[model samples]
Target: MLMVTLLSIACCCGCPAYFGKPMWEQYPATASLPAQVADLSLRTDARSENTIRELRTDVQNAHLLADDTFAGVYATRQGKTATVFGTTGFHLTPESDAEDELTRLTSKYDLGEQQVVETDVRGEHQRCAVGRSDGVDVVVCTWADHGSLASGVFTRLSLADSATLLGTLRKHIVSRD
Candidate 1:
């Protein structure tokens, strides 16, 4: 019995402690699932220029930018990268900050690190967080839905790209003003 207990403990603490397919498998891509917010457009705002510039630089520097029609940004830094979704208006409402919300959601999943990096996406504000499993990092970005607007938009990047982009984002990106 003692041996079994010790073995169980060791096993639990072993690398990749839990047995399961990679996160990509669990959260299958919904590529074919029509765009949920394809028709939404951001409310126009002057502050959006700064937001877009920051997001563009970050995505470009990290090299994770994808050519999507939605006019969002994606980038990788220090082996980490993330995707951002913004409407034409470029504003993320107060309710759309999912960083805080994700911290709570991840708690139930045994994922680690609920630290969220809050920033403005284009003119749309956004929240980001990093989660780790089996020593791999998972980064998620969500755009908060403003009043009368949708709740928010979310996207994620693989651990490798996430780490790289996160590294670059932290070193090169600033959210002042």
Candidate 2:
């Protein structure tokens, strides 16, 4: 009787131990922090009213994705097209160097080819470039004045629409003094 009880206990314990090994093996831990910190960080803000006003009017359903001290992203959708307009204020960095950083950040998207263009923004020479993605187009505009550098990107719109939208957005960007 004693031997039979011991065997039964061992069998019950053995079954769980056997099953646990496969469970652990199937779901191995592989989580690690990113090696490099991204210069751009975005979040969804549903209650914020501090983003670009023109961007909200351009699309049917507009929402603010992020609102940081130096950057912001506004997401919108029209028909089947999804778009994102991002702006970054590089006041802490040198104006001359902000263009390179903004370029690097925008390059993460699938911009096929790039071309420079003139924008309606009030600046002697603002850096405005347009590129085409898979089926969407993107426009990036950068300007420097006084000690501040500002850059904006409008993505996933038609070439004409992107250009038009950027022009409207540029009007609202207050140049640094």
Candidate 3:
């Protein structure tokens, strides 16, 4: 299944996420692109070399501008595998952009019977969905705003957990560029 393949591709690094601060605690929100994304610069191993290469290629081939910033992070945390790719650019229609991103994932992976998860993050428009691929549960989420758009594929995490993690990661990700 496409989702499984992506999960494997994303399970490249095994570093833990920084959960010291409360995931729900709201910090100041900025409407600018990110200078760096957490978990994206982890060290890699032989098992992850091909995966990293493929993910980088895919992100480069994505519909981002020549000067826009991009990153595809493969990380495993608390036994869950997440492969996320995000790009920074200007887009006013976050709602439509979020939907279009979900549509892209729906077509990219065989996610049957997708269920939408409502995610409300300040200063960002986000859409999340839960589905199954190859009998393995997968949660796909995307968030977009005036400055950035990003998507991720997660496995073995509950819908709520998935949404929360992405929301938490956004705090460390989006910053003035």
Clash-forming residue pairs, model 3: none
Candidate with top TM-score is: 3
Worst 10 residues of 2 by lDDT: 28-37
Residue 103 lDDT, candidate 3, scale 0-100? 77
Tens digits of lDDT, candidate 1, 99-176: 444444364334455434444322223344445543544555343322111111122454334433433332222222
Candidate topping lDDT:
3
- What is candidate 1's TM-score against the reference? 0.27
Which stretches of candidate 1 lie above 4 Å from their native place? 1-97, 108-123, 133-135, 147-177
Per-residue lDDT of 1-177 in model 3, one digit per residue for the tens? 999877766564321222312222222223332333343333256655665577556656776452354444455544566666666666656678777877777866665544454655444677778776567788888877656677777788777777777776666666644
Error of 3 at 127 (Å): 1.1
Tens digits of lDDT, candidate 2, 98-168: 35534553554444443344543222124546654455556665543223334556565554555455444
Per-candidate TM equals: 0.27, 0.38, 0.64
Q: For model 3, give the 10-residue run with minimal summed lDDT.
A: 14-23
